[model samples]
Target: MKTIASTNSSAFGEPGIFRGQARFGSPMLSDYVWPLLEIRGQRPGPRLCVSAGVHVNEVSSIEAAIRLQKLFDPKAISGSVSIIPLVNQPALYKYSEYICPIDGKNINFTFPGSKGGTFSEVLCDAIMNEWCAGSDCYVDLHGGDLRENVSKFSIYQRTDDAGLEAMGRRMAMCFDAEIVVGLPKDHMQRPGRPPTGFARHGRLALMSEAGANGLLDESSISFHVEGVLNIARALGILDTPMSAFRNARVACNDYLWVETPVDGEFHAEIEPGMRVTKGQRLGAMRNLFGEEIAEITAPETGLVLWRMTHPSLPKGSSVLAVAVEETQVGQA
Candidate 1:
């Protein structure tokens, strides 16, 4: 891997693999450049980019990106795949969670950021304007932070373009995840959640999640790695016969969270991907004396997507979250 300096156009100009470091937009961090891996297949086709670590604490997704950077060969079927293993470089090194340490902003929400903006914004601007350019399809990898107990899932930010939305849904279901969902950008609007600005990029983008609590579990890592490969196969980015589509994928437009009204030690009786009916006791909030202070019940019948794995619960903490507002797209 030579320290080659190449633009995105030339990076994908010809059929080959290029690996190097690209400069970070932050002048304060003048000494650091983010790692970039570009692989252009032998045949001309779509350009797919896989990014991770916007929330630097998602260790498994980051590890999977690192593995994917080297997994592809130049002789693969068609198109190119760009791997950005680490996006929030400052937060990653400083051990920050969801937000960037330098700018105190969650890089997740700041899309198509500005050059004159904060550290997080500048980095985000590069991702949306530069890295995401010429990408036919984009996949952003993320997962639970240090305090979250998230199960695997994928969501494509719904767009007005019907074709793009359909492709995004296909991309979401092509992976190995517990479920998949499609919701408008206005549904949970925080700028844009899928790395690139959907309106600006005008391309297919989806977010996939696995792993949790900053743990580098191999199973989670494999989930992400296989997910990307499966997508590449389904999208014809790799040299495979392409039989990796997960035919059964559930969709939920909104989530119903089971929260505690008071601070107490929490006990969760359900895990992610389990089915629960309304009024079912999902967990309990107990006092220091081991008294059941409150019973956490499901407000709706749905699938459990995520739960609070930690026993310590603060006031208004969500013990378990169920995927409500569901639409059965296919059979499992």
Candidate 2:
């Protein structure tokens, strides 16, 4: 078992960066080594964990994380921050599909995993046990995958612990995303949820989304960087004041997912962040002969959270997700 050295030093009180590898699977099929970045701050405070690339196709999140690691100066901060910019190394290296090619599992859905399970599960176990076991706050950055087009949003899980739930909400708000989603506690308790993997263990956690089509954009990268800085300020890691925003943010408590009824080529008429009334036409699907196979419509008056960008979709695949607008007039 390879070990990472501690970064604490009392002489000049400067931040230390430690880069190391964590073992993942057996040597028979193939061994995997995951990279870890440990950044220790000058003064003592809470430990903030930021991770990206849980889904390898989310290029913007990975780019943002890399930029964040370079931009942060431990001399100006109070606590330690650990970043794992590329969690799914195999997927990133191979440019694999949405799931880990080795295990054919989505790492995001298999968190707090078993040590003796599949490759993805073992990696998840290592991250939970070694990296996030005692974290004070956790932020998982994500973007639209290679085949998705999504609007900017942040999500926090609803938990029984009021304080943890509140902290998660505050972090999501500090992100200043166009939309803030509060996932229901019941849904979080269901099997294979990512944020719940940390929240259920008493860690305050949330996720942010931006970018799409497996591409990197400057705007998306900047949005994620600013969000992390805001989170640092909100968590007291950074002494700087919180930044202000011009537009009022919207809060979403529920969302509807539209799935493909048949295998075909999809053509979307609406884009992310567009508001549509119930029954409005959103998209359509066509077969090779150009015959329309399906017509997707809005289930309710709400905001389009995400849409499928890849034209070819299998039956039952999700075409888009809509966040239902709340009737109340305050932030959730």
Candidate 3:
């Protein structure tokens, strides 16, 4: 357990207090918003905003945000840092499945959202209009889906945006995550669809993936917390030193997607975070008849970060996993 400083507290309703709100408008309904603002040091620094619990089952992020909030005092930090511990309040109520019942939408996909629409849509619109209006950068935290087994990693948009990429690299370094994914092949595969990405206004964002949803993993929670702290250090919000991996940075073009070739029971031999070699058997697909019909192999050498959890798989369903590849941090 690393220690971080918590400086003076701000008077409620004062100029620089980090405040939380519930109703941005009609459609957007979050049970509560936990907003904390930290101002430290002297010179102006970048404003970094972090959000968690976009998906209710992915509760590790929420824990991470809470831990981070306790570590530092807003009035003592160098720059502005806003922490939103739980983004999907409705879904988080009882560790429910994805999407809020109020409007039933995934907040991540509805970015720069609608003014008058579903609850999630309204929440996105208000967040974008208010807290995220002029953010320097943002971080969207997450974990594996409820029905999947995934490891710790960080996802960022693929591009040659030098400044953004550099910042992303530093943030990833702090996490010391197993894999750092840089592209979205699925989004690219679809002709007109812009990639599965994130941002508040125009800042480059980092989407962190940790353990499987619906289960609490302490290791995952610690990893997420440390990662957020590193980001705070990078942005100069906190006067703490960098984490262990302040030098090593990994770059991956994209993660590999493994799909069910045939309908059968998915007997995955490799769990999340296992390193795999190219041409290796990732897992075997067997039908209810107990007959092994398909052998899933790695398309390229990489780490297995995410895998389907269900025993049965439908033909053509994705049973994908991610791997980190070797690459230099060239000028983007």
Candidate closest to the true structure, highest TM-score: 2
Best by lDDT: 2
Residues 139-237 of candidate 3: C-alpha lDDT, one tens digit per residue? 777886678877778876654455666666666666768777766434432211012333223355677878775677887788788887788887777
Q: Rate the local accuracy (lDDT) of all candidates.
A: 0.75, 0.77, 0.66
Compose the digit string of candidate 2's lDDT tens values, residues 1-332: 34344453222223676666545334422466656666677788878888889888788988988888776677777787778888887786787756888789888878667778888787776777766667788788998787898888888877898988888888888876777887777765643445677776777777889999999988778778888888988878888887776434587776679998999999999998887888899999999998998998988777888999988999999999988766631433
Worst 10 residues of 1 by lDDT: 1-10
Off by over 4 Å in 2: 1-15, 23-30, 328-332
Model 3 misplaced stretches (Cα beyond 4 Å)? 1-22, 25-44, 94-96, 102-104, 116-118, 184-201, 246-249, 324-332
- Candidate 2 lowest-lDDT run of ten: 5-14
Give the clash count for each candidate: 0, 0, 8
Once model 3 is optimally superposed onto the true structure by TM-score, how far is the C-alpha of residue 169 displaced, in angstroms? 2.4
Give me the displacement of residue 227 in model 3, in angstroms: 0.8
TM-score of 3: 0.79
lDDT of 1 by residue, 69-161 (tens): 877887865888888898888776687878888779888777756778877777777776677767777788888678777778877766667
Q: Order candidates by TM-score, high to low.
A: 2, 1, 3
